[model samples]
Target chain A: MTQTAPRPTLEAVAERAGVSRATVSRVVNGAHGVREALAERVRRAVEELGYVPNQAARSLVTRRHQAVAVVAAEPETRVFADPYFAQQLRGISKELTAHDNQLVLLLTEGREDHARVGRYLAGGHVDGALVFSLHLDDPLPALVRGAGLPTVFGGRPGWDEGLDDVVYVDSDNRGGARSAVRHLAGLGRTRVAHITGPLDQTSAADRLAGFRDVRPDTDPGLVARGDFTSGGGERAMRELLDRCPGLDAVFAANDLTAAGALRVLRERGLRVPDDVAVVGFDDMLPVAEESDPPLTTVRQDIEGMGRLMARLLLRGLDGEAPEAADGAPVPAASGVILPTTLVRRATA
Target chain B: MTQTAPRPTLEAVAERAGVSRATVSRVVNGAHGVREALAERVRRAVEELGYVPNQAARSLVTRRHQAVAVVAAEPETRVFADPYFAQQLRGISKELTAHDNQLVLLLTEGREDHARVGRYLAGGHVDGALVFSLHLDDPLPALVRGAGLPTVFGGRPGWDEGLDDVVYVDSDNRGGARSAVRHLAGLGRTRVAHITGPLDQTSAADRLAGFRDVRPDTDPGLVARGDFTSGGGERAMRELLDRCPGLDAVFAANDLTAAGALRVLRERGLRVPDDVAVVGFDDMLPVAEESDPPLTTVRQDIEGMGRLMARLLLRGLDGEAPEAADGAPVPAASGVILPTTLVRRATA
Candidate 1:
């Protein structure tokens, strides 16, 4: 016990201001019917007494918690391993903090925790939710909808039914992938191959789609599957090399995969750009910049996307139309898709 | 907008249960005066109506929010760049979630946000707080104490005054550093050097102290300053090399620094272990295992420390003495310090 003084109560403030408790409550709650002179006296008394209102009591009257739940249906290990989640959380925290709202993080480990999350959301502990459910089979999006809370998804959700009414923020995955492959093509690489991330995730699936849009007629042997890990990238790169020995370029789903591919190419005594031009997505600084020859990859504004999601949800909560970063009104359902850029580096 | 049904109120449940609203409140709040028969009837009514108690209203009675605030006074960029914070958060989230408590993350950007954090803690929004203030000069601990909220620190706080009354959980940083240096010495590397992280952080200071414990009379020229980044490691390594070219071994403050040292050593045409054996603290998987020859380093149970911090706070909230991981009662003020291990790898 650090000898803390007892908190001042509404009654104490009312007494100091020479007003009824009801009048003080009305003034503090910002109720419009209160007279200005009485409210001014109450405010002065509150300042003098250093009175801080009880959040629970205030929330009861306003029906607002000044909090938003950030729900992510991913194992703790995965969420912590990747920097993508960290960047997005930073964006959400900044946006929410600016509005004086708290970020209540709800991380679910597996299917068993989904019910708990749903119940928490429906419990009205937060005004809205920002959900990140990357996998196509993830049940989180549906469960969140069942909670009937105002929510903005972190990425374009995989669900089909009722998706037209859902709001989301996503990087232009397909467009970014196209730009990467096009860069390789322009460099005169005819035997360009693709290494895909787990197809279960929408980002991975969309990147694979973009690869197809460019080399639709290419042999299927040029495509190898990876799980977006360095180890997975190594295995996929080996498989690609064994299947298509003449491949002159490789486009990996993300930077980690690209790093793995780079290591394998180095072990095989192949020179980057000279023998095999490699490009990756995400351009995650530590990975992309540290890879051998560095990585020429697609750079997505991950933090910007997170900020946009929070902004959209906050705007919707305020009964205003959702706006994109440029302040242009967007269709609520379509949400906003931030563009990505191709960052050229030594590898390509 | 999503056709959500209006929430069933306490009055509605009370009417259905054939009891007064006061009785329903007592029953739901687990107040002992309520008869079991009436409590059962109220419970049945609650279940049938799918009535989720309003958190705000319920909190007004119990004075418990079932939530804990995690305040980290680090800029978002720095916090995100390091995996340490993420791992700790995961551990805290797991322990808190298992207790049916929500995690309210409060990240401060700079000194400007201190007042806001202090006010929020004092606002009675959460039951307690878990603070991570690594720097010695950080004002968060004082602010948190001023708020008079029950708090547990994530790391060993650097403050001296009234520290005996504070509860915290931390890794054995000094012991870990000692092990890393001892291993290098056992390998017969006598001319060893050190690269230190920012001395402002207690962890960095403790590690530097540990290095001195093993080599108390070592020349000052063998030690160089680093900020726990690869670039910092590179610059520090260059300085150490310029100052003590005959040094046979180098101990880095962390894995990122070790990775940087390895790169610089390679560029300087020095063979790791053969020419200059290297050891790093924090066997951070991505950096340690991914380093050129893989880094041999000290491994601290970062996530375990987070879990212990939450456990200590939760136990304190329950009016019980804090206990260490081994189930022995610990002095409240001394708190708990988890042990670390030396992980053998190629670099050393």
Candidate 2:
């Protein structure tokens, strides 16, 4: 076995500096009230001996771990398959790194792991938490709140009960969806249809509401349900084609769904923007750009949302005011909702 | 502002149990020599008070943080764009969770972040590290070695200097590439072309060596360089086509590259598996399964590699022998190379 050299100790530094261990401790920890001459001697001795402070001992005195927990309640497959989580994580990681805080990821498989997460959070490991609770029925938010840890959510949490002070960062899903549908309708497509994502998620429900805002009295046959996946989109698209073959346009809930719809349209020998214009939400670069005709979609700053979540939580931890994107102070409970834009591409 | 009740402390538990603080600490720390009745009383007091151990305080005496650092030396875009990192993280997360250990993710953008990562590792914040150093000349390994942290590499590292006991977990990239080329050769493909990933990565270099092992006398024009991306694959495919128009088959370094190659082939009006057969590596489900005609590729146990890396590191930290996938004890420095298999699909 390869052996490493013994690390320099605080005692050695104190002895080398001709000072007591208590004096050296105060200087090493940056605690004031030490003589400048003695402090300088200790600093020089520390540098010469290459003494590194033990984080555990420092954290015990400071009551700060310098780490934050990033908890996501999603299956591994789903988390890896979608780009949304990746973008958000990148944003969170960057923000946390900038603040010199460590990101301790806690990925929960399901309800079974919720107790474990709650225990870990309450165990005083991390200074705070950045949680992603997408589904309305997910109990993670409630559990985290019970843990008494400062937390900022990744998206608009759907739970209504005990949500008074639950802060989160989310894209304007309804507004984005409205813009997509309005764009399609403005293109002289009177017979427009909508493909909805899983309604259990707040984002999906909001997108559906946005679609309804444009086509309030549309026929039930024009709306088909998708699970925000390519396969789901294909099935939904085929169902829409069967129920309303004369439909001139389709707005999917997300880019992955749109990619599936495009494949189905191509198989049915339909030309995009000619036979049937299509618009999708979430301009996920890989899916939106790589699609057959590319995809005209709503662009949300996914990474920004993540960064904001971290900022909000960190601010809360520091007892500072939370700020919006434009640097305006936001009430602690109100949270921030970022606007989305329509990205034009070949599809619509 | 909403305020949480103060947490119950060890002193509170001690008072409740009618014992000294030192007695409560001994029982809570599971120290031997405590009377069974006294320990039971202390445990009851802890449960009644809902007292949770302070990780920092406990870590001071135990010298164990119950945390591991996962360091990846890749830009956020690349790490998220590819599915490999996600899959590996999932595997590592599962194993760590089972062991009641936390995973601290440290993502480095480039050379600038190396010093910060080194300082963190040297600070003794984590028990060990799982490092992913892809490039041949990456200096991270040397820095980590200097920090004297037990580390397990995600992929086979390329550095040869001071590499006596460097442990790593890697898929048989060369063997997997050889199998892909041999499968193409078995189909009577005499002019088999190869598209390579960035040559700086050991995996890409090993795959290229495997291709040479099969087609020792192949024409130089049959090879093109790709950066393991769809765009890179498209350019490489077009170059291969221009250089050797008669090439019957192409083996791409990864699934994303193959997807790009497939798109270019379709645009040029070539029938898949008829006019030109294509094979890819790393059967990343999304890209491989969603490509034009799906993709015939080599499957590596990516998640398993992560799990093994964690297992190896944890065992080393515990002063136990490192075991291979089959549970056979191996020398620590020998490392473990997992086997890969070929998965057939529509394209080939």
Candidate 3:
């Protein structure tokens, strides 16, 4: 093995300063309890020895690393390829930087990685965690809970049980879908079809629910599932057209899917907003603006949601926010649901 | 403040097991020197007490954290919005997982973040670093060097001094640009214009250099600067057209820029390949494949480069790789350059 010079330790600094290890550590850590003269002597020793305090040693005194883990359980490339996570990451990074905290990103690959994530959180390497557990049957919510770390979920997790007390920051998925479907219905178009995102995710399921809420007695054939990909959207759109030839309006789960459906509609020589009105969710600007008719989409403040997630997490970690009017400790249920608006364009 | 159960300490476990602290530590760390009977006793005590060994204490003994910092100093939103960094992150995650290490992502926003990054590295929180110092004036390359950590740069950093021994992994940018320009020239398209990505980045500069190397003494009006955004590409294309209206071919620095140029060309009543043959670099599939008429561009193995960066850093940390003719230590210049290929499509 290649040899390098040994790093100076606290013990070496203490010996050089003719002081106890505690005194040297206090001076190095900037603790206020050390005497000025002794602190100066210890500082001189540290400078002379070129001592960089060991992280493990420093963390023991401070009980913090000023770091947070951002876990993304996206095994599929489509999710990352899209700009959704990118925008959210930007928001999170900005907030973390402002707070003088470091972000440790954990992109879990599959089921096997769940255990690794669990171990990392349990190790107390980070102050808290901000997790994106969007899909149903994601064991991360439970694993994070079992680890007992302060965590904030990015999106509304798809869990029917054991997550009511979990803190999360999510866009109004059900409400956004309601707005989209209502807009389509307001266009005097009956036989409205819903192109759903992957039903395994809560956002997609919620959107489907919103659609059903509007057209409670509609035919089941109007709803087709998509995996939030252009190809999947195309297949779903084709199926919907094949099943419901008279359908005049559609609400796609996202802009990319809407773009795909638009392509199919154009190929079939159907005019948007006349023969058929189309509205999409997540006004991810590039996909939304680039759609043939400049897609009318449900605009959620994605970056704002990301910022709120980090903010809520940091506040929870602080535990001294003046939110408890009753003088009892603040509960962990600081769940936030941001509003979404309909972005009108030529497609609708 | 909220109250939680205090974590059981090593002292409690040792006392409960009626063993020395050293013996308990050895048992907890899975060291083989301890007697099986004593180890069993310690394990039982640990289980009964529900003691999770403090990572700080464990790290003190091991002198390692098994973590690496991934610093991306890209302030521009366009960079993150692209799939380039995401694909690289996936590759880095996969490779780090295989090696049983953790990834700590540091997204530096501006010059202010450089000091924070430097302090974190010098704090010794991670064993090594993988930095993407793309821009010419980025201080990260210098800061990382000053920290004296084993670092592997993700791209060919732009530095005229003090980085001769810096190991990096980059795609064959110059050769890729050459192939693109040569392909357009072979199509009998004279007065070919070039839309360059932000000149501050070495990749863009190298591609520009490659263009000039082939088309020596080209008119300055044929080169338009773009900021690697679709809007910037459109603006640059407009400027190029205004300066040299007869330009029959275009080579954009990236696919996003090419997409923008395509939009402007179409709006100006010019048909691609027939009116203006186009070539682009960094055939990021989403942008390249989805662009109108599809983009004929340079394809680089972005994920492979990320994996290579992590691999080189890890190998350096291992310090036992056979690289010398006479069993000497491996030099610090293990730079890797991956080849890029010209992907032919409808545009050209």
User: Which structure among the candidates has the greatest DockQ?
Assistant: 3
Q: Indicate the residue-level lDDT of B204 in model 1.
A: 96
TM of each candidate vs. truth: 0.67, 0.65, 0.68
**Docking quality (DockQ) of candidate 2:** 0.17
- Expressed as tens digits, the lDDT of each residue in B202-286 for candidate 2 is 9999999999999999899999999999999999999998888888999999999999999999988889999899999999978
**Candidate 2 positional error at B13, Å:** 39
Which CAPRI quality tier does the interface of model 1 achieve?
incorrect
- 2 or 3, which is superior by TM-score? 3
What CA RMSD would you report for each candidate? 15.6, 16.3, 16.3
Q: Mind giving the per-residue lDDT tens digits that candidate 2 earns over A236-263?
A: 9999999999999999999999999999
Worst 10 residues of 2 chain B by lDDT: B322-331
| Each prediction's number of clashing residue pairs | 0, 0, 0
Candidate 1 C-alpha lDDT tens digits along A201-274: 99999999999899888799999999999999999999999999999999999999999999999999999989
Cα deviation at B213, candidate 3, in Å, is: 6.3
Q: Evaluate residue A334 in candidate 3 and report its C-alpha lDDT on the 0 to 100 scale.
A: 54
Q: Kindly report which residue stretches of model 3 are placed more than 4 angstroms away from their true locations once superposed.
A: A1-62, A179-192, A241-249, A260-278, A289-297, A322-333, A343-348, B1-64, B172-200, B204-300, B321-333, B339-348
lDDT by residue (tens digit), candidate 3, B1-348? 989899998889989998766557656755433456777999999999999988865654335567788888876364466578878987877777667677777665576878777877756567778998778877777887666466788988898653444578899889899999999999998888999989999899999999998898899999999988899999999999888888999999999999999999999999998999999998897899999999999999998887777777766665444232223343344567888999999999
Question: DockQ numbers for every candidate?
Answer: 0.19, 0.17, 0.21
